[model samples]
Target chain A: MTVGTKHTHLTYPDIDEAVDDDVRQHMEGMMEAEKGVLQAREQEMEECECKEGMFPNPTPGRRAFLLGAAAVAASTLPRGASASSGKAPAGAIEFDVPDDPTKVQGRLTNDDGGYGTRSQFESEARWRFPTKTKETSWTMTPLAESEGIITPSGLHFERHHGGIPTIDPKKHSLIVHGMCDNPKKYSMDDIRKFPSVSRQYFIECSGNGLTEFKAPFLKTVQGTHGLTSTSEWTGVMLSTILNEVGVQDGAAWILAEGADAAVMTRSVPLDKAWDDAMLIYAQNGEAMRPEQGYPLRVFLPGWEGNTHIKWLRRLEISDKPFMTREETSKYTDVVKDGKARQFSFTMEAKSVITFPSGEMKLPKPGFYEITGLAWSGRGKVRQVEVTTDGGKTWLIASLEGPIQSLCHTRFRIPWMWDGNPALIASRCIDETGYVQPTIAEINDVRGLNGHPKFASIYHLNGIMAWTIGADGTVTNAAHKV
Target chain B: MLIHWSKTVILAGSLVAFIAAAPASAQKFNFGTTPSAEEIAKIDIDAMPDGRGLPPGSGTPAMGKNIYANSCAACHGVNLEGVSAAGGAALVGGRGSIGTPKTKKTVESYWPYASTLFDYVRRAMPFDKPGSLSNDEIYAVSAYILNKGKIIGDKDVMNAKTLPKVDMPNKDGFIPDPRPDVFNYR
Candidate 1:
């Protein structure tokens, strides 16, 4: 009762020592008076004085129940007021379990006071790509944690010609000039007013698989093949814009330009522009993320990603492409005999096993689900074959649904491990019935110019193999059988 | 809570006031200003293979020797041969290695256009410093290299007019792509 004093009847010692002698005596006296009153009430019940709905039989075990109830009540009394008063010792505090367990112990406040931070343990992947200049280099996405076909907008990979421009969409306009019957400029709003459509597709860099040409160059699948990504883009088709502008006859090519510091530009053929090209303004169901060209960009399905210009500003119709520096000096592939191959656009069929890939180690040999992504710019992936025994035998993998053309098709195969070392690889076959070739076969056809040039080795859609060692270390086994 | 409502209203009002007070011109975004022809003419020294963009300038090979000594000799050696100076790429010789494995194609050997030499140098050159040379200096250097390679005479004096007319050895070397045929895959 006094919070700290031990009574002769009570067995447990009270932890608090702040209560004085007077408070202890007062609590003990109150307990004694309550006991006396209870005894008198029992005597009266024995004399046949009963209340309504009370048997008043004066059972012998009833006193024990009353004593237990009184002990519980005594412990429930508030003695930790001093704790809230800030007078308790540094380490003597104890938390009480509330009568209602659903109640939260504390309130959280944020800058808006309505939002709260996620649990401290939760984390998301951060981008880590080197930069030579803001415009030229690229940053990779963490593909391992990506779910479904949509890459989370924040983690989308980036490749810019000039630095990212902070363009205010209100003032931005795209001019369709040159070989058009009536050259017209459309503001961002005007362009969006046209009939809009959405489709899921994958944009692959022409140099996506270049590093894997000679050998397994990068450790992670993201590093080796992250240049390819799938997104649901919403936009008005370039055909619709060209229809409004009324393209003139004999216009072979159109030059597209961006509003960045570099004023990046590229030449695209008119046929492709009128066919499947999209002047995209939205990605993954939202306004385009800044890294994916915030306001608007060109989305050419099944074409090289660079040709899908970002921060789009101008489109000039012409009979011949204005061969900008990007086309002539950079993207053009110098072949084996000093002849450079230009306009090599399509990214060929390729696939790589993402799970159990390089840098991953198996904890113990058991049943493992071998999963990966396969895609073809030519058409939909018809079939994916997994070679568990290094191409000696191949089995068709189960292709997941939503296999649209020019999109990444997910493939999975259940593989068993007997704890022995083995080589694993995947090969994709396109709808065109063209099988993805091996490194040797590709090089034999495209003649490796001893000097590495972008043109000679632009498309390296070769089979990627991963070797699991006896110790369970996985490595990019390019040549090791 | 009542005070908090008043504060929120005041903040929203200020934001609306600020946006309303902003100028209409400030709201419109312009990619870039259209530079005047005079201003652009100062920097548009791009020389096409036919010398389309070359400015009015002329230089003899004798004067080029001195200019080349001061400007081009550092990266390209004094004899017009390339230097192996760590970062500098080779600039001369290696002409007929186009189809061979030991090809070392350079300006003297591989370049198909004399005007390209003038164009490239005027736009981006002098490894450490780009766009620093005058049009006359670029023309003089172009003449010196062409005379050394025996493609042009010392008195040809390359300007906008003469630079385009200079005949290059491999001018007809390149052919348009005729592919997607049965032979392309084979």
Candidate 2:
């Protein structure tokens, strides 16, 4: 079907098209009113075969499904909103579901043109941080609604310097030059020919919980610490490529540059490159998403997400750190001595109870899983300590198996909340013996800069406390502490 | 028959030599091609703090004013005050505000090297239209921001040599993080 020509508004009422229209409107500085939705509804009605179907029983086909879906939407949503509101999610599709699933034959295998979309009802998304522009913004994964350690590739948090670029693998090539003897450039096909390794790693923005530093600024756990995500990234080890390029003597640092509009650059230590870095082409068993740097990206395992340049196009080895805009002014931390800390790479051990996290209502609290994501950029999370009494006493939480180093480890503990007020929190202890400190403890050293208390925004791995109220409502206890 | 046997021996000998030299040279997997000079020039835009990789063009604040007004000032204010609605960071003031409550992270207060400004602008600036500025225009705009921030004089021209030489005020403000600053572990 032809899309809107004059306005380029969505002519189709599919979820992805609707989302694009919303983003397009947002980019044009137009707040979305119902004008576009109304136009969409009119177009949708013309294509819709609902006139062929009746209420309780009609032809068991697409027409009947649309009628049923509309009924469900009208009942579930507010006064004016209906199915033609067309806001399911970006990746979901309009599927025809029967009123009775057991009576009908299932959809044929490979019926969806060899690929499929998620259920329209299961609409969990990475909510974008309200930055002024969409180009240089970040999105937070719905961590509270998350399950398991491996964050679904679609739900992975993204931080884009410039907007995501659509790059073809055939056209894209990575040039490994400067301070290297060979100065070689590898295409995607060339790089794929080498023996590659797939390993799970979590990339956390050092500024993950920048809002929760001084006080609890945001309400949800997603708002507090949703800038981190884990995926089984697949690629040749950077050392393998480095070997092929042949590093010269005195090559201390390497500048990783992206192919995006910003051409994002960061100087990473050569040691880190040799240790665990990967020139990743695939993530979670598939090619990387455009938002996650399609075709190629430099994965500096466990480093700040910024240092892990997306859409990575160049690796220029150098003798000294190139004090780029990212390293020098932006990501540096202001410390206690009236000085700033630069190149603080490691995201220290951190954990939080996501189930009983902020803004979640514990319905008549009985047996609830006090679970959340625990991770350490330093190494594997050895133990996660859970505290329900405001850090007074701690208990060891059980970590779900397959705890990969530098990856998100899901930890769970059974909590019998007695419908009484309780402060629940979790702290991680990595293999390095570094325990995640309390917000107050973190503030004591890093928070107090001889002036009044305004905390440094990066590397906030402090224990996040969520207070369970007597009425079975969980809220942020960061401010209280 | 005799010629084939000699050729086989030479191939085997060369294979052995290739295996021996693997560690010393870059022959592992034997992948990738050497990028041409023009291809390298298109993307090799990073500038080192020691004035390396900088082009020869020079510019002054006066030369930069028109460029900044036309392209940059829409986002980064006309007077470098920063348009908050546009997400442009103020490059001028906030001289001694790092550790204070009113820490404003302007270039004057935070960025260590003047070369960073030149490199960043030339590679990625004007926010919306990155890499659109010429090296001369970038040098000029860098000088304009620096001049407004009180890092450079009105008359000083910014080339590769002079840009690196301009001592940023906060050069000594940054220190290496000696952390895991907290030791209490359970």
Candidate 3:
């Protein structure tokens, strides 16, 4: 099951060997492809079976449910009295109840041991952008549901040009060629053998808040700011590999290509490669997920997500940019004068309030802790400002938890709600001294040449505001400055 | 980690540490094998704007007509207008659309270099079956698309030299990214 001495021709024998014997047998019986084996393994992870009556799907709107329950209690029950008559209330366990905690017997340890499952209500999921095809679609990480800077590996956001490729680590080889003394190909095992280093960084899509260009189009923070996720990536530094191959003089850019269906390519700056660029094969604590480029991928901190080419198969160093279709026709930002901005790689500082955000209820708004995530690709967030009255006045929010460069930082501010309607928003200032601008401000500069509104959707790191209704409902405050 | 050493002692110790770490870092962590030329050529399909990696083949628009109709038209339209369901973008027209309200980005109007088309088609094309086109087919398709967009003559042949020479319409429509563009200087 080791990376070395395994299959080296895109076969899944090594992967099958690593998987459970029973699962492998089941997969083999079905004559599934390598992707099927991995998918089966995923299915096995979610094999928590429960009786139908035990956990019926909860109704959709939390506000409506809570408000309805409160109304029923006020109308039927005496003030400050319990809803129950000292017996088990409705929806409570009707079967034999074990009152003594020490005597109560939990589910016996079954054959399947050591695997875990999240509590039903504590489940985190990525929401997919509704596109025509799944192959070219993207899914947003639930930033609102995340606890700290590190996004759970399973809940990380995904953006694919030709869908996720089921690459066999044994078959994969990263070729370092073009403008080098030695053009060598490193196998998965060979790559692991190199002096490796791990560092936590955030990869954010330049189009993170594109939908909120003219207005707060998305209903939730996940939709507006979920295109970012942090991970402790482990791999050999790009400079180490470049030095190993002897990077030739005059080499300025490296054309990175993936092995996916699209063969996704981008021209990365050589300086960044020498600085902190990584040829990461492991994410979080294990091998990268298939969607995140299973076998290998290149990660450039403080750069756009597309530049971190996944399923990285080749590197061609050259003096100039390749100007591939990705850099020109796609990722380029078209502004005024009909001229497009090319190689606009860096994602600036941005922040968004997640708690008490859109579509959520304030149940009994008294002293609620308003919190959200803030990050800057340029560097660590220096400060975060929150405004409960739109942008009329802003107060510095306390940044909590670990603070790392190019990593998402959690910020919280204690807000006292007057129970009346109010507007809420947050903005970040990065260490580079760049402050997050408003949507109007961004458009003013880009549209100086009279470009239409929402013309350029990439890199819209504008402030987002949520309007809280008196009836305990929160919604997007579109066109808010 | 540097608590005990005095200023001069720390400087000397740091110098020693740097010297000690230098050779270890310089020592080759050699783990990969140098690929043979043949092996390298198998996947090195990037074509530079200056016609660096064009393959040894050529094709004309006449030769590419049938190939385009059979393989590319279903997604990229028979006239290269682009089919939405296929996710193929319109390959031609959109001339003079930049800076205007209705800016239509197409191969004829938006692409700055012609070699990019040859490179992209060879690497990924036909929507469903990419990397399936031959070198000659790629050249022929490039010629056909360019001709259809009126960027080149109908009978022109596309090759390493000719393809790079075919000046795209919007060659100067791009500008370098000027960052910190917003008025939020720290």
Candidate 4:
């Protein structure tokens, strides 16, 4: 069998021999050139003065401006070695500076010792929500600064109930029991041996934009829509294991319990488990980060993030819901009329224009690209409409190609800024034909009581609007339609 | 019209018949190993609303205060007010505050079932050392918190049977999510 050969009848023997050999060869190649450096170089280039000494290739007034900005940024820098010690040779053998020109001077050869990091010149960082506790609070992904659909694994937004757990894969095992003919225990090796599949999907916390329920609260697009992240998840299907154990007839719910401190539990309907539920061990072509459940997690695409239990350890099938603390005491969406909504699993369609968003000022706007991300839990995003004049007029934004179901799709539209104040917004119509709602429309139906304010804040998928001033300043127009 | 309807029905019947036959021939790799009863017990810590997984242990509110003070009070507060810096949530308050803007949802005001408290505390409390509490200690602490919130009496014993039977104040607070509730109808 050659590379890329599709196995039609994959028995254990076929997988053990052919597939294992392929995987071993592939992994060996990856580990050798593991830095993921994409550039080629000459056999030997003369080490110029710039290579010997660390200095920002002088750009007229750029040095003076950056020095001032650097001084201001230093005060807020966390307790660590400075981002750039003056003498530190960083940014692919270039001088360590916020904005370096040596980057355009081209990169070094792909041969690094081992492992890799993002370039030092790229200074984008996730802003932490100003909460009293870091463990419970989340850090917002810099959405406005993002370039593509897939959030780099490092930049994926994090929301942990009991903090990220460090689990040894050697010691970790998933026990599948309750209402099965033969209850099973699968180690990570046993799981990897099963027929594997890779899929791209988005996991949005149902509490993605809880702050924007009553009024515009957070200042940046990241703060507004950072909780949702898309990734290429690779794993074995839950159905594969469920079938192996031989699910019993009367089973309705499956309780997925995590190995984290909280031992977080959520009851997933048997139908969803049979449908697209995946026990993922890898994300974006590599082992998942510890923050992202590491060795194993159940990925229930399009469902609330909490339902996709991380550090997954147990799955108990039963006729009734477990109604664990996570599903009952928390994660339930409280609506108006003083009642909460239970089992609101599927996250509806949502969209947001990332660029030209709050806290971002356009440097003299002329013709600008209005771009953002749109996704639906139910399926693919069908259309994204950009409205420069509030909701008066809307034009269908061009979706970047290869749109996948339950994954973030980048949408962009060209806009001529008239050098005057205007309301700009974007909304998505998903494959389900569900048009994303406005804040007012959603609040009206849910009934906004002053207590806890808006009735339900769990699934806030309303259209986000930004008002651009004549001076090129963009602010949230959350109240405007 | 009768002839045409019969022809269409015949076409659909065969399609249904083919679909029904497909699963019988479907493949199963039969992966993984059967776990023993001992192996199951080592990890099966889940507590259901029906008290199916509750261990054999009981404790009263009187026995709980000591454990709560030593291990939990530093973060959860002496009054269970919750220390923000420690990432603790206020556990007992916010009665009748659900519909108001100043809603301070607490264990007394919001939790619908008593089994949840026992389950949560047993698995995740004491912050520093989670899943370290004994079943009786978990029951005791749960009993203490519930009693302090005035939901349960001080003498009320929290065991598998009694814990599931304890009716919570906000038991009827939640409604099924009849969503597509927003104006975004598909």
Candidate 5:
């Protein structure tokens, strides 16, 4: 049952036989060897950090007058007798450096007894949208960097009012009161008693790309349009719950509220609730993660994300709407003509190119895969057109999946960058024949009054453009005339 | 031409019947499915843009100042200035900035209607404790904020009748949407 002596070849049985003298010695020796390797790696990393300025300029033709350049070169050189060995070039050294700082000590043994940490090399964090109130704000998913449709629960973006609260599910209960024959209270377990269903859908913030209305406001796709994400949600139909509670005559609206510090509330029309709304308890086939509302959240398909109240605690049915603060002071569209348009609930169709986008460089720029995401609240994206030289001409990009209605669809195009300056952008057309409008078109419809609050400019779904320079630098370009 | 003639004959016949029955239908003012006064009273808690939904309760500016200080001062600020340093929205004194570069819309200067303040607060306010304030408290706070902003006199009592009558400084600031025009598409 003795384990292997080598670090890479270490097996599990060694721990059980650790009492044996031979096995104990082998385990001790392996630990010492791993520690030595880790220490040496740390020293090498410190040296690299000290001489980071000494590295050869990756950006060709830049002035290389940095004082640490020599140190950077020396530290990067190969280590040990391998440098003198005939196998490699003279002065060449091979350093076994780990890809991430967390992995420097190597993989943990099975009995490590702790949660795993993400690699230090991963620089992703929750993308936040600047807001008027810190307690009530939103964060977005890193959709462009993600490989699949299922947003990782930890990486699931959040929109909260009054901040996130820690709720004990045992003590929490959802009360279906007002305008019902049988006002009922259901615990988390009571909700699970109904017939369960699972479906994948995308929830998009109405203000997903609000910042980019004027221009490209963020450098990364996560910052620009990360407010939308898709997840396989498991739950019972709200209609089924309503049926059990027995809706009374003349019921029109239901006031849904969260138990967060803000007690966020919204008035949802009953017709939509009976159609496709779900009281979700699980996300991505697992128990709901804390950020995705741990215990439960309401899911209203094809509607704005705010109405899908997370950490749901109550539902009060009434003949009229509550006109909550979120729905009034916020969310309502203020037009240019001194009029505020209320009840604007749907998020329009939109698309954006993620790869070769801002803050990226085209490495030699030949044939590259131009990839991005397209989605529509009205229905499936009928087509996505890419314009290589801005809006003058466009070609239809290939859609990659069985286009689902009201879902995020990945689109790709085989683009050849000819080492010349070019402007790239994508436009989406939904099943409803509603073309994604330009910034001017949206402004014309919404109108701008110059006042930041009443500017009617929050939900901007215009086409986004990125410019690639001849020198391989990519920048967010303004919409060309 | 034959089909057109036939359709006209049928329309004429129907119009004659409708004219004949119009008087009978108009004899009674049918407010369709008029709920009992008691039933209506139970659910008519909405605050309208015209102050149509204000409840029977009333609040004065003096009482409202104390209530706001206790419940809302933490986030909204004492002068209703909003916590600008902490990034909270300014709730008062941004009156003439609309259509200008430095517009700071607040209750005193920017809101188009006073009814909105009552509606928004009755349903959601105090940030931490929504739907917890009484109708009188909501009315008083609305009066205090409006009076402080100089929109109304200190003695003014905000009730269903007075709220809609109070004129907002930026009442005419909003403009209609002009889209799908040559300016938008091109």
Candidate 6:
């Protein structure tokens, strides 16, 4: 399979086995050549001495500047694709672009190391959080630059307890035991032999917008609401495998474990397994990214991202939740009454405005399309209402089509800004007949009384408000309760 | 309108018929191989509450002091307060401050089960070098940390029998999730 330079922002993981064998030997020498070629970015962008903010102020020849602002990008530099945050992805080759594309012939076809990378000009990528250890931290998707419902696989948000492990698929097998009559182990090859199903779903970190609960301290939309992403995952139904090994009577819970250095585990309900649980091996039509549990990962639709264990290895069926460190000490909600809430699985409905969001100054907005994403852990988003007057009045925004169940649905509304200080926001109504609540409403019920204040922050689907100033700058209009 | 209703009824009847024809079970996909008892034992390492899966071992807090200092103290402070190097919360103290604004959620304060303390330390402790410690070392460390928080006596032994029976301070602190916590108004 060949991925063309069609979508400039999508990274096509060329995982065809035939191509890997063909390019294995030749690619080794190319990788060695790339080593120790140090003086590149600083060397090429020497003209960018002005150093506006990491990159130079662009005079005119700019497209990367079109997204951010005034970055004098040295396109002359034969540079690798910058994901802006994590390690650079593979298969994208660096070559010189002609000053005028019409005057020169481009690089040879099928020479891009067999896979495709996003364009260098598209600098949108995930950003990491400052946790104690970098390995235990997470990265947020660049929601401000998002275009559609599906987040690019490379740009998908990630959370890891242990560092991402490199596991060979041929050796990895999932062991299923415990409260089951016939305990079984299925290799990756064996699991693939069963019939498979593909579905589009969104995996959201329960702590997605935790920072915004008390106040909007995080400046960017990426910081505020970027921990969720949608992907069309292809996998065999977990129930199909449960059928292979009969679950013993009274087996209600299953402990899913990962093979990472941390050996993470979370107990899942048997009902969820029968409902929509899957052992997904592929994402966005290709093998999963290493950061996303390459060989395999659990896909528990509509559940918190943490429960969907990555680099999955074992399954032990039982009648009780494991109450692991994550569930008890970390993810549990500490409420006002001194009692914590455990096993809070679903992420309620939430939405955020991407364009004209935090840190982006709307350049003299007369007519603009206010676009953003809204999704629910419960089910399909029935409606998304856009508000431009700080929760005064609302209008039903247009929902982008073929809205699937438990997935991110893009919403858009046309607005004519009159250059006044106005608050832009969106609220969602899921199919369950529940409307997204404000921060004040959430505080009233969940009680924003944690040690850190508003520490009962998980499953906070409060409406996000971004204020657009007369000077055309947009900032988070969080009502600090 | 009457014809449309009749058509819907017919469709519903066919759907019920289809449901009845196909059993509500998947035809057994026996592609999986029955794993050997030894293979299952090798990977089944998670320990649940009530002493469910604790390995056979014994240790006292006295034997755990050196292990804690050498292996865990770099991140978790010598005094049981976490260091910046580890970026983890304190292992002790914060016994009652969890739900308050001055909350400090340590193993002593927030954790609901003593089994969880042993389980977490064994599965992922020392941050960098995880699953490296022996079963006895895990038991010893668990006992030492518990004693530091005044949860157990200094001479209390931590074995499969004792660890599960040790009730944590916040043993009954947690409740099940009651969500859609707040509703939207028209």
In the range B1-186, model 3's lDDT, one tens digit per residue, is 456547779789897787678774475767899998887899999898999998999999999999999999988888899776565677998798766765667899899999889988988787688889999999998999999999999989999889999989999988999977897776
lDDT of 3 at A342: 93
Top-scoring candidate (DockQ): 2
Runs in model 1 lying further than 4 Å from the true structure: A1-134, A450-455, A479-481, B1-186
Model 5, span A34-58: residue lDDT tens: 2443243334334332322211111
Per-residue lDDT of candidate 5, residues B1-186 (tens digit): 999999999999997797688663232221112234454344334565555557878898998988999888887887787764444456876566544434455777657678878876765577768767898899999999888889989999888888889988866654332322223211
**Candidate 1 lDDT, B13-125, residue by residue in tens:** 99789768976324322222333445434433334454555688888687788888887788677877755432234556656655344444456655666766776666456
Clashing pairs in 2: none
Per-residue lDDT tens digits for candidate 3, residues A206-298, read: 878765665455555776778999889999899889888888999999999999988999999999999999999899998888999878999
Mind sharing the TM-score for model 6?
Answer: 0.85
Clashing pairs in 1: A171-B29, A333-A455
Expressed as tens digits, the lDDT of each residue in A1-481 for candidate 1 is: 0001001121212323333333334334323432343344345334332222111123322332344334434565343111122121122232222233244333223332453333211222323333323345565555544455666666577787555779899988777776765566777888888769999898877766555555554555666677778888999888877776667888999878776655566779999998899999998887997778768899889887889888888777777755454554445554545665567677778787876676455655788888888898878999999987878899999999878899988899999977788899998988877677777676655565523321244666778888877655566776442
Model 2 chain A lDDT-worst window of ten: A52-61
Candidate 1 clashes: the total is 2
Report how far residue A78 has shifted in candidate 2, in Å: 29
Fnat (0 to 1) per candidate? 0.05, 0.74, 0.63, 0.77, 0.14, 0.84
Q: State candidate 6's DockQ.
A: 0.41
Score chain B of each candidate by TM-score: 0.72, 0.84, 0.87, 0.84, 0.73, 0.85
User: Of 5 and 6, which scores higher on TM-score?
Assistant: 6
Cα lDDT, model 2, residue A219 = 60
Candidate 6 C-alpha lDDT tens digits along A1-481: 1101111111212233232221333223222221111123223234442322111112212332232222214433333222233223232322344445455555556655678666544445566766657888888887876888998898899999999999999999999999887899999999889889999999999988776676665656787788999899999899987877889899999999998988888989999997889999999999989889878888899999999999999999998888889899988888879899999999888888887676555556588899999999899999999989877789999999999889999999999989898898899999998898888788777776554533586877888988877767667787621
Binned by DockQ into CAPRI classes (incorrect, acceptable, medium, high), candidate 4 is acceptable
Clashing pairs in 3: A338-B98, A338-B99, A433-B186
User: On lDDT, who's better, 2 or 5?
Assistant: 2
Ranking by DockQ: 2, 6, 3, 4, 5, 1
Pick the winner on DockQ between candidates 1 and 3: 3
Give the poorly placed runs of model 2, Cα more than 4 Å off. Answer: A1-87, A448-454, A479-481, B1-27
